[model samples]
Target: MHEDTAYPLYNRPWFSVWLDAGGNITMKGILAPAIKPFTSDLLDLFENEKPIGTIDANGMIVADGEQLIFSTWMPPIPSAAFDRLTRSQFNARLGKNTPDQVTISVTEECPNRCIHCALPDTDNRESLSPDAVKDVIDQVIGMGTT
Candidate 1:
């Protein structure tokens, strides 16, 4: 089981999800404008000593002069069992929690036309499958490893 957090559900493991005090959820693209490296140690956010928006007494997101409105809270990725998913990205396990960066190169087909090549005789060349490797990279980057 993952650790339960009291910080009102503004999680980044999945894309931005902002749940307010009235049980409302907003799936705004909050990443770009947000303070980077969200330490998750505070209930509020700030920018240049100015309160951008957020952290009401009940942890509701308060955008000045703007009424937060959204009828439904949709998960970025839908799930099968639950009618509503929480902020933990369905509790998906994370990669190593280290300040580490890695570059991964995947080889699809044998380059050398040797006996070890499965289809050496034919002209078979395979490039990196981006979609296939994206999930891996996402998980890795999610761990705060660039």
Candidate 2:
């Protein structure tokens, strides 16, 4: 059994029968009969046009035969770091849509003391207030839209 934690589900030993262009069934491996019924149900669920069951708020597999294609929890609101990452990824895909952008780092609480840091090396570090951070984000968003 493939008991690796990385593949949370489908980490158990399962069999797959491959059929080539010609109609032929070749058994790959044998799994417990107890697992067979669940596997068939899962396949049916995925094959259907619409999802078979509902997904709970916590994002767990709440019901059998429920296929979860994609899920994400939206953060309370976008932080500067979050905005920057989103902008960068968007710019990479849609270069024409994204204008040339500059970033003003709001804080320097980096744990790693990189030698080439532009900020002064002092144990005492200051961060922008919540209001100041909000203003900076608003300005950036305005600039981005223009």
How do the residues 1-45 of candidate 2 rate in per-residue lDDT, one tens digit apiece? 111111112322475422221222233446645445544543332
List all candidate RMSDs to the true structure: 15.8, 16.3
**Residue pairs with clashing backbones, model 2:** none
TM-scores for all predictions: 0.22, 0.27
lDDT tens digits, residue span 17-82, model 1 = 544423333444545245333433222221112212332345355542122222223211122111
List where candidate 2 sits over 4 angstroms from the true fold.
Answer: 1-99, 120-124
Candidate 2 yields a Cα-based lDDT of 0.40
Best by lDDT: 2
Pairs of residues at least 3 apart in sequence or in different chains that clash in candidate 1: none
